[model samples]
Target: MSGHDLPRLGSLAWEPALDRPDLLAAPVLAALTAWAEQDERVRTQVAVAPIDPDHADTATLNAVHGLPTEASANCVVVAGRRGDDERVAAVVVRATTRADVNTRVRRLLDVRKASFLAHERAVAESGMEHGGITPLGVPAGWRVLADARVAEPGTLALIGSGVRRSKLLLPGDLLAAAPGVEVVEDLATAIDA
Candidate 1:
């Protein structure tokens, strides 16, 4: 479905991402623009919304914007090291789940240990705000691992547009097919109630 088909939210105006470069990071804008050019679905389906920086966290964003928690996704940067070599990846999962960094991610990365990247490093390296690092514009060579649940067709993931002052909304399937994204089974485990 296209953005025009979706209901409008209060105050948060939805617009084509390609039309608002100021709301996105350089790399993210480049990638999304390229994808929109190459795929008609992307051009019509992707949307962006300006948000209050203070309410950028998933729960707060959802509550204030009337978006559902299940429709949100979180992208976390993880680092793994073996000897002198270090590998970093962006792990994307539903807001209802947490990345399985200790076991699955560590094993997949083939590193001795896997841990969340330092907050400062993640923000600086990604060229994004501390709470707004996303898989779309992460530094090159960093893997993007998305949990299977992130690809469900009807679900729209409200993800960072590389900044805390705005957010991107797109179908999960589109995110799964984004450049460098790898949809992995059981990449995240469900959170306890």
Candidate 2:
């Protein structure tokens, strides 16, 4: 994508707070922030904001919390063995839609079958509390997959802070900050609300 094609998040309507806690300051956010800072191309287009922890879900999280849904999106990381194989991979899917792990993801990851990582294992492996896991700060040796839709220029994404007390609004460029994230075109299939 051309530099001009990149969406400058400042154009979007988002609020910033001087007193608000830094969502990226947490382990997850810190890791991601460091990564962005290390890359000039990514640092230029990235931004972060704090949100209420209760607003974790995309549907009601924004309404009661009084935030812009357009600026918030969900992040889900799934890890498990294939159908009958022992291979394990982490799949990241957006909250606006569910990951088609049962079909699309399993095939894309080239695993026999896949399932959500157990609560204990997820938190343990990610070193993040449940409800606060972001693609950032994940331990080394794990695979990262992002929804292609997230790659759309100017898109803002809601990610966890490694803690359940807050969230961060980061530029979509974060999708590129990770080491091995693949933007899958059909990773997420819409579900009936």
Candidate 3:
């Protein structure tokens, strides 16, 4: 995922005010950048400034070419359980592809149940501020899983930067390379072609 080899998704027309370097100066950004530096497979190809109002779902699709065919996909991390202790895990699926958490992840994690963590707890425990939650800065003990559809060719996702004001465009394969990530099909529903 070196900046050199990254194929242009499309004309990157947007001009971000890189002047405000603070946009990516947070701890979460540091962690994500560190991971990207360590692995060429799971690196951040580009960091895009999220719209002030946050049009992430649509903006992410538009930012990349040959993507966003009818429906969009994203990777989300949910805090769950591991041996009676709370933990976090990621699930990648289309905006149209819902993760059947109650059924799929529960069985996968061997937990009696699974649910989206409370917003407050998610922000605090993940060490990432709210709206900026990305699997990048997730706690070490947590597990990650991506729906196989995430690996589909040309798939793009809107991943958080540990801050809501910004996001990064990540190829499905690169996302799969996130630390401790477990790629699986357990969390997705099919979309008609």
Candidate 4:
């Protein structure tokens, strides 16, 4: 949506993300600026909203903002080993679905097993807060895998801005088209929620 057309959810007062670097963590701001340099649409399409860090989780964030579950995506860090080398990646899936970590991610990483990265390692390595890791600005070598469902037309998903105090709203197609993202089918399976 355009800047003026930004959706008004329950309690969030949306502002252009570029207008509030303070709301974004260092890495997130850097990534956003870089992306905007390459894609002008990024400047208008992305937005941010300040929030209580306590409401950072998807369920709580949606509840407080009157956002539907489908309006957000969750980013998870996964790591697996192949021989002596370790591979790391971030997976973005709709909040209504869970990543097929064991079947899909493991196969994609070419590892015997894949598991969630340690909380300490994820936060430290990503330069982001514990509950606010987005697929944007992950380490260069780390792959970003987004489930196809998240990138369908007309989807705008709320994502962390590398901090719990704010969030970024971005179109799913833009996320799929991001420089390092790989759009994969069946990467996640729907859950009861």
Q: Identify the superior model by TM-score, candidate 3 or candidate 4.
A: 4
Q: Sort the predicted structures by TM-score, highest score first.
A: 4, 1, 2, 3
**Over the stretch 1-193, how does candidate 3's per-residue lDDT look in tens digits?**
4443333334333222232346553655566657756775333254455445344444454545434532345546666666767756766566667777888877877777788877787677777666566666577766777777765555555455666565555666766766677878757766554
- Point out the worst 10-residue segment of candidate 1 by lDDT: 2-11
Candidate 3 RMSD to the real structure? 4.3
Q: List ranges where model 4 is wrong by over 4 Å.
A: 1-8
**lDDT for every model?**
0.86, 0.60, 0.59, 0.89
lDDT string for model 4 (45-103, tens) is 88899999999999999998898889789999999999999999999999999999999
Clashing pairs in 4: none
Would you estimate the TM-scores of all the predictions?
0.93, 0.74, 0.73, 0.95
Question: Top model by TM-score, which number?
Answer: 4
Error of 3 at 71 (Å): 7.3
lDDT of 3 at 81: 68
Candidate 2 deviant stretches above 4 angstroms: 1-26, 41-46, 68-71, 82-88
TM-score, cand. 2: 0.74
Q: Regarding TM-score, does 1 or 2 come out ahead?
A: 1
With a 3 Å backbone cut-off (N, CA, C), the pairs that clash in candidate 1 are none
For candidate 1, the per-residue lDDT at 190 reads 97
Give the alpha carbon lDDT tens digit for every residue of 98-163 in model 1. Answer: 999999999889999999999999988888888878888788879999999998877777789998
What is the C-alpha local distance difference test score of candidate 3?
0.59
